[model samples]
Structures are given as C-alpha cells and as structure tokens.
Target: MSITSRITGSKHTFDSVREVLAKANEEKSGDQLAGIAADSEAERIAAKDALGSLSLETLRESPVVPYEDDEVTRVIQDGVDEAAYDRLKDWTVSELREFLVDEQTREPEIARIRPGLTSEMVAAVAKLMSNMDLIQAASKMQVTARCNNTIGAEGTLSFRLQPNDPSDDVENIRHSIREGLSYGVGDAVIGINPVEDNAERTKRLLDVTKEFIETWDVPTQNCVLSHLTTQMEAVRQGGSADLLFQSLAGTEAGNEGFGIDVDLLDEAYEFGKEHCTASGPNIMYFETGQGSELSSDAHAGVDQVTLEARCYGLAKRYDPFLVNTVVGFIGPEYLYDGRQVIRAGLEDVFMGKLTGIPMGIDACYTNHIQADQNDIENLAVLLTAAGSNYFITVPMGDDTMLNYQSNSYHDASALWDIFDMGPAPEFETWLESMELMEDGRLTAHAGDPTRFLEGDR
Candidate 1:
C-alpha cells in the first residue's frame, strides 16, 4: 500500500513499506549505490514522517521479503512473541521510538516490549533517532551474556584481543596475544582471523590460542574466526575452541554467499555446545556489517540499516555470547565517509542491544575508504560511551592480515581510563593477580609481552 506524508504543503508518497524504510534512512552510499536511497533530503524527511506513522502491525504484515520466499523473513515472522505483539502492534512507529527513549522505560520495560518488535520496527525507531538518541536509548538496555566470563556488565567494557598473523604463524600469533593480555585486553575473547580458512589452519589457530589461555590462566575464551564449518571440523578433529565464529548476513541469499544456512548454523551451534571447551552456554560468535547483504546482492530492496537489524534478529535465535558489527570495514561504497560510518556504528549497536543480545563494535576502516584512524577512534569513544559490550582491538590499530585499521590494544586501556571503566570482573581480578593493571589503570609492566614468558607468573 502507498503511504503519503505532507510536510509544508508538499506531498510525498512512498510506493511500499520497503520504499518508505529505504528513503527514511540517513544518507548512506550503499543505499544510493543500490539505487534505493532517497534523491533529496526533503524526500528523506517525508519518508521518515510516513514511516513514523506506519503502525507496528503494518510493518509486521509487510515483510520486506515475502515469508514464503525467504527464510530470513520466515525466521523473523515466526520468532515474534505473538502475545507481546498483540499488545503493541497497534502502536505507531513513532510511539515505539518514544517508548524506547522515554525516561521511565528501563531495561525490564524494554525487554518486555522487545519481543513485540521486528527488525523493521527496530530500524524504524533507529531512523527517527538522533545519534545521541540512539546512544541514550541503548544505554538503558545493557544485555549481558557469558561464555567463559560475564560480558556487558554495567560499569564494565571488554576488549577482544585480535592477534591475527598474516601468515597464520602460531608463535607470532601467540606473542601478539601475550602483548594484548599484558595490556589488560582480551577479557572478551582472544580471537584470531586466520590467513587460511581451512580446517587444519583453523585447528592450529584454535589450539595455539587455547594453549596460551591455559598456560597463562587467562580468564577469557579462544575462537578462531574461520568459517563455521571449518571450525566445526577443527573441533571434531580435537582442536580446542571456546566459541564458534561466523559472519552473518541479513538474507538467506546473503548467507548462501557466505556458505551458511539456518540448518548449518544450528548444527554448528549444537556441535559447539556439546564439544567446545567453553563454560555453560553462549558459545557462538557472529560478525555483521551494514552492507553485507548488498555486497551479496541479497538486500531485497531494503535499506542497509533495516537489513542489519535483521542480522541481529537472526543472531538472537542462537543466544550468541558476542555479536559485533565490523562497521566501517565494508568501505565507502556502503558508508561513504566518517559521518556515515559513525552513524551506522551507533545504529547497529542500538539495534543489536534492542534485539537483546550482547553487542560490540569493530570500529574499523579499510585503506580504500575515505576514513582514517581518527575517525575510527572517534567511533570507539562514542560506542564505549554508549555502553557497548566490547570492542575489537588489534595491535596498534592495524591488522596487516586483514589490511584494515581497527581500534588499538592501547585504545582499549585509554578508553577504560577515560571512562573510568574496567574489564570484565573476572578478567580484572586476573589482571591484578598478574600485576598488569592496578586501581583500574595499566601498571608499569602493562605493555610488555615478555612479562608472560618463561612462567613469569
């Protein structure tokens, strides 16, 4: 059905809910590249006006991709809490945004209404929110999860120690992990993105990371960021892993490009649950970004923001311990510059937390993108202030293997110091025991990898 909005006597009509959602988005290069973004800012505002008036029921009834045709839509529609939806379905998208940002809307209230919301609704509310609006609304809903230790606890921020080697060399990767640990990072997970995506290489990476964690008694988990199938094979072959990692997309076709389907994901999740070495529950790790669906040509004419929210909706089904958007890594085609990247980062985290999963950010950029370290650093600070569960920190903000710049190992400690936050409780205790950190600040020996050598403990 066509929806029309009149602003200042100018009437703007969108042909479908899909058109309204796409046009309402803040300027994004990917949407424009897809030939779906609004042509003018006035039209964009008009689309927002129409979207804000669209009832939750309308959005629910209007799946971006028909349920019969797409598993992603089927999963989202089937997963809704019918009882909760029944209560809030009549409310307009404007009301939903108000409910989320209302001063009285606490975590429990948000949780109560979350099941009623769909990815489109989440994206709708996000579109109407300002950057700080997104931050304020998300700060109220701190969804914590646990694998080895608790993450997303209030007054705490965690960092994933990404010790990726360009050549998939175990010893070099091991030393990078040590360096990150010495600086009091890696409380979230010591994850590696392997140069080789095969099972043997994945197994080797997992084994090396697990051995280091055991040797140092680090209160964290280990994951090799290879394909889920590869990781499953690694685990089956007796390579230890605490978490299974995969990159997810918003659509079934996008997932196909990634060589994954819901069934394969479910099988891998079950396998990780039964065989992986982590503690109780929350064993899956997922990475998403704004334009993955578009990159795979599976966006279904929807805006990147909405498709991104659907990714979180899919992730919620597995109860993942960690889910992060590699926000700026996709490059300028989807998120043109610093402003767009920052906006997407905030929007993704807000949507992820609103979906009731642990959320983090890999505030990163590629060399070809019109962004730099300063932009990524700015994003890290904003996300940290927004109470993100974690951040991805590679050594010195550069991943030679991935050829991108992310937040640095030193950036994590700097943020902790700036924001008066510490690592996960269990990890902080371990850090104190090792004298790497004291009184929530890095100690003198904090940056030395050699401190962990030769049974220094």
Candidate 2:
C-alpha cells in the first residue's frame, strides 16, 4: 500500500509506502514513520461496515418506531384541528391531556369526557408523548378500571373495597382523582382493582370501571383497562373493551401481570371485532424486575414464558395497528446480573414472536445505577440489542429527582435522552463496541457495575 505525507498547506496522495518512508528518513524522523498519512479508504471502509452492523443491532433492539416525527405531527395536526404546538408548548401532564381530550371531542365518532375531578375517581389517563414531534393527542381516549378485588392480596389496599363504587359514583370520584393527581407530580395511571371471584363478578367489576370511564362529555380514545379484566376469560370473550368505548378503540389490560387467565389470544380477537375502535389506543405492558427476582404472586421472576405467551396471544388476536404490548423491568434486582437481565428480556421477545405483538419496555426502578457517559452509552447499546424498544429510566444531568420517586418531577428531557445518543462522543464508542462482549454479554467498564449486557441467548 502507498502512503503519502502531506506538506504544509498542501494535499498530497502517497501511492508507495517506501517513498514516504524514504522522505521521512531523510528528514531525520525518528525510527518510527512519524509524518506520514495513510489513505483513509481502508478506515472509511471499516467504519462503514462497523456502522452497518451496529444499525442492524439497533433495529433488532427496537423494531417499532410507530410514531415517526412527521407521522405524529400529521396525525395530531389533522386530527386535532392543528392547534399550533407552539401555543401549547411546555404544558403539564394535565394541560396536555386536556388539550388532546378537547380536540378529540370534536370528532363525531369519538366521545369526550371533560369530567370534573372528584375524590372517589381513580384516574387512568392514557397518553402518547414525544419530543419535537407532532403528537396526535386529539385521538380517542379511554380509561378503564376493575372494581373487583381479585387482583390484589386479600388484605392489601386494592383487595378491600374503596369508599366509593366506581360505577355508582364514578363521575365525582374521577373528578376528585383528576384534581388531586394534577396537584402532585408523577404520571397518573390510577385505577381501582376490586376483589371479584367469578366471571359475573369480574364483568360487574369491568362494568363499574367502564361506567365511570364513560361519563365525561369529551371522548375517550381508549380506556386504560386494568389487568383484572385480562384475568377473566368470560370478560375477554364478552366484548367488554368494545362495549366500553364510543369508538371501541382502546387497549385490553393484561400484558403487565400474569394472574389474569383470560386467553389473551381469544379475548383480544373477539374484543377487536366487537368493540375495538379504529382510533382507540391499543397497547399492553408487563413487568420485569430489575433485581432479577420474581415476585411470589403473578409477577414472579420476570417470567419470559408467560410474557411471550401473552405477546403471541395479543398479536394473533389483533392486527399490528390495533394491538401492541410492552415488557418492562421495574426493580433494581433485574440489574443484579446483566446476563440474567437479558435472558429475561429475550424471553419477552420469544413471547412476542409466539403471539406476534410488537414489544416495548418501560424501565422503572427504585434504585438505578449512576453512570458516566461511557457507562450510560454502553448500557443503552447492550439493553437495546437485547430487544428493548422503549427504555423508561431516570434522566441524566444535575436533576436529583427520579421517576416514580415520592413526589418527584421527572425531567422530560432526561427521559428523552435515555436511549437517544444525540451527539455524544462516548455514545459513538458504545455504538461501535456494541457487539464486543466477554460471554456474548456487555458489561460495564472496569469498576462500573451500573452498566451491563448479554453474552449468549
């Protein structure tokens, strides 16, 4: 190969290494060839190949980029009367929710629920937020809850009946919860889980959840149906979700917990046909522990098998456009062993394949590892490669607050940056080194336990 040395203020190409070496030698250069410039073609070619490989890895990690920037904006603008996002910029959760609900109510097909807040209401506001994107929040919105008490332990808060019945006094309760939650900081997904035994009771529970959800003057895109209904085969088969919506469009709750025995596949399909509205929100999510420890109840051990089954069932039941599921890790325990963490995640993928539901993850943890740039990027690459489309974690920067922290405000920008590399130097390093693992798993740099990855399946 030819190497060339560039003269001052000159661009030159070297075809022969020897010639460049001879010139350098004459210049009394040290034993090493100091001032020579090699053709960058080789490096360029290597980088190209490397980036191509990394792109494939990223794709494998997150397959669903459903709301592209333009698409999100277009849908929002077209569907919601094109309220200049600029005018509604920096609005809080409640403000944004209100904007979308108001816009959605204009559509004759969708109903609106500008329900006033009340103490008895358990609010479950469904939202799809993004950065620098047009969000079609003006679509259908629905919130569902099961007042039956089968979900929680016998003595737990959810197991006991709350002061108000969601069905009998939903409107006032919902108003109270909405007002109360908006006063606090944290995303509100409030819903009641009443203890109910049989299908009839379960149906009654769902009916209560539905009745409360339907009272607002505004339209609901879809109800955030709790996993309680997901447990009822009868409810799953009974057209509960469709029956709940003006548009019959919304999610069927179940991907989060395993207790619900409803054949997700059968129920989702039937629900889709009878009540699933074209514009309703549709996605389910399940849990994975950060510590790698499974709970004794329905959520034990981040059961990939159960997760996969649920995913497969959902996919079989609904078209890609109608149904989606997210599998997530919630505790620090799942992070205890990077390898195990990935294994649990892959099981989720296996479930997704079996059932055919698009998957995402909501990374929630009580104690997250504090990381430097390299550590953060490395973790991102590894986790993404292991089949995580969405990562909901603590934000980076000076903000001391964390998500799900007791009354702490989560920085929207930090959450946005979790998986987004932006233009960081270490991010490039992590991207380039994504495939390098000791046991086919990524690990944090020496002395950094916060970062990790997978080694083998």
Candidate 3:
C-alpha cells in the first residue's frame, strides 16, 4: 500500500514500507548510491512522519522480503511471540518510540514487547529517533552472554584484543596479544583475523593464542575470525578455538554472497556446542554492518537500516556470545563520513541490545572515509555511555591487516577511567592478579609486554 505525508504544504508519497524506510533513514551514502535516498530533507522528514504513523501490525504483515522467498523473513516472522504480538499489534511506531525513550518504561517492559516487534518495526523507530534518543533508550537495556566468561554485565566494559598482523605470523600475533594483555585488554576474546582463509592457517593461529591463554590461565577466550567453514574444518582437525566466527547479512541472498545461509549457521552453532572449547553455551561470534546487502546487490531495493536490523534477528537465533558491527569499515561509499559512521555505530549497538544479543561496536573507519582517529574515539566514548557490551581494540588504533582505524588497546582503559567502569568481573580479577590493573585503573606494571615473556622476565 502507498503511504503519503504532507508537511508544510509539500506532499510526499512513498510507494511501500520499503520505500518509506529507505527515505526516512538518516542520510547514508549507500542509499544515495542505490538511488533510494530521499531527494531532499523535507522528503526525508515526510517519510519519517509517514513511518511513525504506521501500525506495528502493518509492519508485521509487510515483510520487507516476502516470507515465501526469503529464509530471513521466515526467521523473523516465525520467531515472534503471538501473544505479545497480539497485545501490541495495533500500536503505532511512534508510540513504540515514545515507550522506548520514556523513563518509566525500563528494560523489563521493553523486553516483554521485544518479541512482538519485527526488524522493520525496530528500524522504523530508529529512523524517528535522534542520536541522543538512541543512546538514552539503549542505555536502559543490558544484554549479557557467556562463553569463556560473562559479557555485558552492568558497570563493565570489555575489549576484544584484535592482535592482527599483516602476515599470519603466529609469533607476531603473540607479541601483539602480550602487549594488549599488559594494558588489561582481551577481556573479551582475543580474536585474530588471519591473513589467509586456509584451514592450516586458521588452526595455527588458534593453537598459538589458545596456548597463551592456557599458559597464563588468562580469563578470556581465543577466536580466529576465519570463515565458519574454515574454523570448523580446523577444529575437526583437532585445532583449539573458544569461539566460531562468521560475518552475517540480513537477506538470504546477501548471506549467500558470503557463502552462508540459515542451514549452514545452524549446523555451525550445533557444531560449536559439541566441539568448541568454550565452556557451556554461547560460542558464536558474528560481525555485521549496514551496507553489506547493497554492496552485494542483495538489498532487494530495501534500506540499509532495515537490512541491518534483520541481521540481528538472524543472530538472535543462535544466542551468540558476541555480535559487533564493523560499522565504518565498509568505507565512505556506505557510511560516507564521520557523522554517518557515528550515527550507524550508535544505531547498530542499540538495535543489537534491543534484540537481546550481547552487542558491541567496532567503531572504526577505513583510511579513505572522511573520518579519523578522533572521530572513532568520539564514537567509542558514546558507545560506552550507551552501555555497549564490548568493543574491538587493535594495537594503537590501526589494524594493519584490515587497513582501518578502530579503538586502540590503550583507548579501552581510558574509557573505563572516564566512565568509572572496569573490565568484565572475572577479567578484572585476572588483571589485578597480573598487576595490570588495580582499583579499576591501570597499574604501574601495565603496558609492559616483557613481563609476559619467558625467563626474560
């Protein structure tokens, strides 16, 4: 059905919920590139106005991608709690927006209705929300998960030690991990993106990192961010890894481009449960971003925000331990600049939390984006305030392998200090034992990698 809005005597008509969603989204270069963005500011606001007035029932009825054709649509539609959906089916998106931001409506109330809302409904509200609105609403919610240790507990901010080397040098990665651990990093998994996707390389990387964790009895897990298939093959060959890592997309076609689908993900989840080294449940690690569908020609004429929310829906199926958006890594073509990158970082984290997934942000930008370290640092501080579960930290804010700038290992401590936060509880105890941190602050012995070296210490 068509939705139209008249604002200040100018009329704008959107062809479908898909059209309205794309137009209502905050300025994104990806949408513009797809020729789906609103042509003018008034048009954008009009679309938002139209969208806010859409009932949750309408959104539920109108799957952005049809159920018959898309596994993702089926996952979202089939997962809703019918009773909760019935209770809130008639509410307008704007009312849901108010409920999310209202001081009286805490996470419990929100959580109760969370199962009723679809990804489109979530994206619709986000389009109507201001930047602060996103942060304030998200801060009220805390979603925690466990693999090796708990993540997303209150008053804690964790970091993933992304000790990636340009080459798949096991020793080089080991050095970076030592340095990061010295700074009280790696509270989250020590995840490495390997230089190659071969099973042999993945196995070797996992072996080196897992050995270090065992030797030091570190309180975190180890993950080699290879394709799930490669990681599984390595583990089948007797390699050690605490988590299974994979990139996810919103649509089945988009996922297909990455050589994955719901079936493969389900198989991987079951495999991790049976064979992954982490204790108990929650062993999957997923990475997503806004513009992946469009970049891969699988967007189906939908907006990036809507596509992004669907990714969370898919992720929720696995109850993943860690899910982060490589928010600005997609380049200027999708996020465009610092402003867009910051907005997307906030939106992704907020949406993930609302979905009840332990969410975090790789608040980063590529070298070519109109953003710098300062912009990413600004995003990191905002994400911490927004109660993010964890963040991806590279040595010195530069990922030599990925060719991007993210938060530095040093940045995590700075954030904890600024916000009176500490690392994950178990990790904090480890840090104190290692003399890397004391009283929620880095100690004198912190930042000294030599302390971890064999006999040289």
The CA lDDT of each predicted structure is: 0.92, 0.27, 0.92
- lDDT for model 1 comes to 0.92
What is the C-alpha lDDT profile of model 2 across 198-251, one tens digit per residue? 455445544544453344211222233334344334355552433221111111
**TM-score of every model?**
0.99, 0.31, 0.99
Give per-residue CA lDDT, model 1, range 1-457, as digits (tens). 9899999899999999999999999999999999999999999999999999999999999988788988888888889999999999999999998988899999999989888888988988899999999999988998999999999999999999999888988788878988899888998999999888899999888888888889888889999998999999988899999999999999999999999999999898889889989994899999999999999898888889999999998998899999999887878999989899999999999999999889998999998888888999899888888889999999998999998999889887889988999999999999998988888888998999998885765
Candidate 1 positional error at 300, Å: 1.4
Per-residue CA lDDT of model 3 for 1-457, tens digit only, reads 9899999998898889999999999999999999999999999999999999999999999989999999999999999889999999999999999999999989889889988878888888999999999999999998988888998899999999999999887788889998999989898899999889989999999999999999898988999998999999999999998999999999999999999999999999999999999894889999999999999999998889999999999999999999999888988889999999999999998888888789998999998899988899999999999999999999998999988889999997799989999999999999898888888899999889988896643
Candidate 1 residue spans exceeding 4 A from truth:
455-457
Q: In model 2, where is the ten-residue run with the lowest total lDDT?
A: 118-127
Task: Supply the global lDDT for candidate 3.
Answer: 0.92
Candidate 1 lDDT for residue 361: 89
Looking at model 1, the pairs that clash are none
